[model samples]
Target: MPLKKLTYLLLTCLFASLLTGAPAYGQRTKKTRAQLENEKKRNLEKIAETKKALENAQAQKEVTVGNIKAIKEQISSQEEQINLMEQDIDLIDMEMQDIVSAKEGLETKLQQLQKEYAAMLYSASKNSGKLNKLSFLFSASSFNELFMRYKYLQQYTENRKAQVIQMNKVAALLRERQSNLEGKRSDKKRILSAKVVETKNLEDLKTRQTAMVGELSKKETDLRTEIEASKRSVTRLDNLIANIVAREISRKNKERERLQDQEAKIAKNRPTKQPAKKSENLDGAETALGRSFGASRARLPWPVQRGFISDRFGVKEHPVLHGVLINNNGIDIQTPSNATVRAVYDGTVKDISEIPGLGKVVTIQHGEYFTVYANINQVFASVGQKIAAKETIGTAGVSSGATEINFQIWHNTERLNPESWLVPR
Candidate 1:
């Protein structure tokens, strides 16, 4: 029973080894890493947005320990499978060594058997020519001795024939097994290399997952605190702006009263012809302002100092995820996130307001031209304020997420596409 179990175990190991060897061998069959790499790199920029989102998500709390555990489990499973494949290959190698030894032994025996067969065939031919085989049986002294001699000759011929046939069969089987073992050798090597790479990738993924979970644990608390602080700041800013607007309106009323008194004196003293010329000039000024509203593309100025348009103004499909369309009123510039958001041209500040969905937006008016810079994190100028070209009017507001500056070009009420102005990336 012990012998039986041992034999069974040996057979089971052999069978299992064979099953494992195939997959190890199979892994080296095909790959396209360069294609995969080219695809991945030509594409990291697109995921810049996703990375930004993940960065924001990191600051939040409520990281599920379960998800982290699951990732670890998956990594463990892959490692276990790799290990099994390695063990199976090792067993197969041992089996191959045994087969190799058997093959060598069989080869030696085959050579010896062939030599014996060759000698027998030669003897048979010589005896046929000289009649030694016939003479041996006929010259026997007794019938029993002659019968015994005949039986010995017959058995010798039969044994030689059987050995030649057996040698050929064994040689064939050995060659076939050797060829299979050679294949297994290459297969085992390939599988080992693959497992090493996969193991590294798994380790990297696990590390990232663990780090993400850790970050998430702190991020939630931080986000809540940030949100509350932002609300209070927003409220305070609103009240301050209201007071500023009231003061400005009062100042404008007083200035208008002073201008009216000067105008009344000038009306009594100036010539009638001067008033006619003044009226015509006023009409022309109004017409010029109206014509400048949403003027030709050539009149527009670039927004940022040193950047190209990464994305254009208009409706277009997303670069990474196909079939998804994005509507953009203005172009997106590719530059460092920390870069300053400056005025595109000389303009007067029109309205600075916190737009719920759009963040803080600052509207500036240049003659009759209007520009809107949205998603502002900080503002340096206020309403009814004068700003020069390239002035640092506001700083971009980032949500600890993707830092994007939403900009708009408007002429009074007419909106112009920013794409027409900015150079394409």
Candidate 2:
């Protein structure tokens, strides 16, 4: 209501607003930092896993495709780690700058409060004498004026106390900001140090990859033979999966036709035309399951607990052979020997078969979708058995010169890229 009180109220509101708004930026920055750190941790774990796979492959005492793949994967993860470190450093720098700016603003506010308090103290000293205070009240023209003078003195005293409290709070906040800045600097230093180690590791991996590729190039003749054998195994597995999938599709089609005929007979028996409920169709569950699985695109868990993709879907040039291409229907995941394989989604085991060089295979039907896990050493799922997501299905087998499994996702007849469906490593 009074000028001084109104001014004080406005200042308090402004300060409160600033305090409330500040955390939004800080929270967002903190979230970004956390995300980067988490990604970096995952990347480091991937590098460690790839290193173990490489060590196993190297035990053969000669360069192999598996060894080369492991080296490349390690290098990729190492590079990504370094990149994350750089991003972390940048974030730290930015946050430090913000802290500096905030500290400066707080210091300015503290100084302003001190100046105002000093002025109040100076004015208060001039009226320190009891006679002066009484003279001022007595000099009022009326009782109302005198009462107003008394209230003014009380408000002035309260404002001075409030100013002191504000100054103390601002000073404390400044100290906190300075400490945070120091912590950020330390974080940046640590990331920079880790970056150095990661960069060195990356270089080492690159050297190993180059040497392995060179060595394998010299054995191109044997490489071709290996490729031929792998191709035959792939071809045979493709045929088997195709046949199984076709039979399943045909069976579902016949059932759908039978349902359609039954629905027509019921409709004919009705007195009036009635619409067939879509939910009653056999494809209802399939549609719902397909939608659920599709919604989980890029979020499905890996078939194995720990592994890196050694070979991707579609066709790629052979690592050692010139002008030669290798075609893959599914992505190959390289894992530790006897790694337990699991279903990526809820499905029913539709078939279990074995190829000569590819070992055993398990095919699971998820509504209209089918997932094929080949190169399995053992199968834990039987045909017609219901499987839940992440349920252990089998153990990985050594195939194509590596302990890995070929993972494929199919939409009835069309093959989908398994990596696209899988979560990023």
For each candidate, how many residue pairs have backbone atoms clashing (under 3 Å)? Answer: 5, 0
lDDT for model 1, on a 0 to 1 scale? 0.57
Q: Using alpha carbons, what is the TM-score of model 1?
A: 0.35
| lDDT of every predicted structure (CA atoms) | 0.57, 0.83
Candidate number achieving the greatest lDDT relative to the actual structure: 2
State the TM-score for model 2.
0.91
Model 1: ten consecutive residues of lowest lDDT? 276-285
Give RMSD (Å) of candidate 2 vs. truth.
Answer: 2.7
RMSD of each: 22.9, 2.7
Quote the positional error of residue 405 for candidate 2 in Å: 0.7
lDDT of 2 by residue, 47-162 (tens): 88988888877777867787777787778778888888888888888888788877887788778778877877887886675457788899999999999999988887788788
Candidate 2 clashes between residue pairs 3 or more apart in a chain or in different chains: none
- Model 1 ranges off by over 4 Å: 1-63, 122-130, 219-425
Query: Which of the numbered candidates is closest to the native, going by highest TM-score?
Result: 2
